[model samples]
Target: MQILIVDDNNPVLEHIQSLLIERGFESVTASNGLDGLEKAQQSHYQLIIIDHLMPIMNGFQLAKNLRQNPNTAQTPILFMSTQDIGVIKNTAEAALVNALITKPIDENEFISHVYRLLDQNTQHQSL
Candidate 1:
């Protein structure tokens, strides 16, 4: 599966990409929200892991834009941010983003969530 990791920090992007790659996922990355949006428009991906605070667009804006795009409305988005839960909830509600992950991520938990999501999606598609 293809996964996109969008974050302003180079380290964060590299870490996530490497982890996903090791899991056999084809990874794509963008340093800013605008780049992420452009990449998203350019191709289809199975999942998107986006950081909340970014230059130009920000994760909330990116999520809202992606949801508005007819081609990506059904795509799964996982928000990774340091934003407070209340803010996360408000932004998520506006963007229809169902998943929110806090920052300083735990490696094992991140992988577990990613696998769980894909497994669930597969099960849902089968039925």
Candidate 2:
């Protein structure tokens, strides 16, 4: 599956990319939300993993833009943030995020969410 990872932190971006690559998943990355949106428009992604806080644009704004674009409207989005999940839960849901993953990423949980989202995408495509 092809995944897009958007984060300002270089190490975190590389870590997630490496993890996905090691597991045989292809990933593309962007330094911030605006860059991410441009990349998203340029290509196709089965899922998107984005950080909540960024310089160019925030994850919530990015998700809102994605929802407005027909090509990305139904694509699953996963947000990674250091912020409290409960604090942003309602906003994330309102923005149409499929899941909100807390950072300092748990390998098992992260991979599980990735696989689950991909499986869901696959099922929808088959239908």
Candidate 3:
């Protein structure tokens, strides 16, 4: 499955990309929200892992935009940010992201969340 990862930090982007790759997952990346939105428009992704703070557009904007686009309306999103989890959680339902993950992420939990979202998508598709 293909995943899109958007983060302003180069190291974080590389680390997440590496982790996903090691798990045998294909991933595409963008440095900021605007670029990520452009990439999202160009392809179908099983899931998107996006950072909350970014240039041009933020994660909330990105999620709102994605929801408005028919092609990506049902795509699952995982929000990763350094912000408070409660704040992120509060906006998640409105933004339509499937889950919120905090920064300095725990690798195992991140992977678990990824699989859970993808699995849920798969199950939804089958239904």
Candidate 4:
């Protein structure tokens, strides 16, 4: 599966890429929201990990646009944020997001969340 990891932090992007690679997913990394969005349009992804606060474009806005596009409407989006979960939910409907991961990352939680979304995406494609 092709997965895209978008984060302004190089360390965070690399860490996520390592985890996805271990899980047998071919991944791409983007430094910011604009680059990530462009890449998303260029190729379909099984999953996308988007960072909440970023320069040029923020995670919520990026995700909102992705969902609006026909090509990416069903693509699962996982938003990573250091801010409170309530705040992120307030910015966008909680149910609209596939999942949310809080920062100071936990490896297991990240894998579990990503796996669940991937499974869901696969099932939907089969239908």
Candidate 5:
């Protein structure tokens, strides 16, 4: 499966990419939200992992844009943030985010969410 990971932090991007690789999943990375939006529009990804706070565009805006495009309207998104969970959840619901992961992320938890979302996506596609 292919995943798109968008974050401004180099280390976070690398870490997530490596973790996905370890799980035998391929991924593409973008440094910011605008770059991510361009990449996402240009190709197909089974899942998109986005950081909440980013330059040019933010994750919420990215999600809103992606939802408006028919090509990506149904794609599952995993939203990551360093903000309060309650606040993020409220905003995420509007964006139709499938899952949430808080930053200072726990590796195991992150991978678990990734697997669950990917599995759900696969099942959905089959249907």
Candidate 6:
């Protein structure tokens, strides 16, 4: 499955991409939210992984825009942040995000969330 990963941190982006590759999933990366938005619009991704704090646009704004587009309205969005889970949860819900992961990422948890979201997306598409 194809995934779109949006983050300003190069190492983080590379790490996530590597993990996904190890799992046999293909991914596209964007350095910031605006770039991410453009890329997201130009193609279809089974899942979108976004960083909460970014230049040009933030994850919440990106998610909002994505939700307004019919092409991406139902796409699952996974947000990554270093902020408090309670705060992020409130904003994530408002933005229609499917899940949130705290930074200093736990590889196991990250992959688990990825798998669960992808599986749910697959089932949703089938339905």
- Give each model's whole-structure lDDT: 0.83, 0.91, 0.92, 0.90, 0.91, 0.93
Instruction: Count backbone clashes in candidate 6.
Output: 0
Best by the lDDT measure: 6
Tens-digit lDDT string for candidate 3 (23-96):
99999999999999999999999999999889999988898899899999999999898988886676534457
Give lDDT tens digits, candidate 6, residues 20-108. 99999999999999999999999999999999899999989899999999999999998999888787676535457998889979999
Q: How close is candidate 5 to the true structure, as a TM-score?
A: 0.95
Error of 4 at 74 (Å): 0.3
Q: Any residue pairs clashing in model 2, and if so which? A: none
Cα error of candidate 4 at position 112, Å: 0.2
lDDT score, residue 87, model 1? 70
Query: What's each prediction's TM-score?
Result: 0.89, 0.95, 0.95, 0.95, 0.95, 0.96
Tell me model 5's lDDT, rounded to 2 decimals.
0.91
Cα lDDT tens digits, model 5, 1-127, are 8999999999999999999999899999999989999999999999999998999999888988898899998899998999987877775354478888899788999999998988898999999
Ranking by lDDT: 6, 3, 2, 5, 4, 1
- After aligning candidate 6 to the native by TM-score, how far in Å is the CA of 27 from where it should be? 0.5
The parts of candidate 5 lying over 4 Å away from their true place are 92-95
Lowest lDDT block of 10, candidate 2: 87-96
Of 3 and 6, the candidate ahead on TM-score is 6
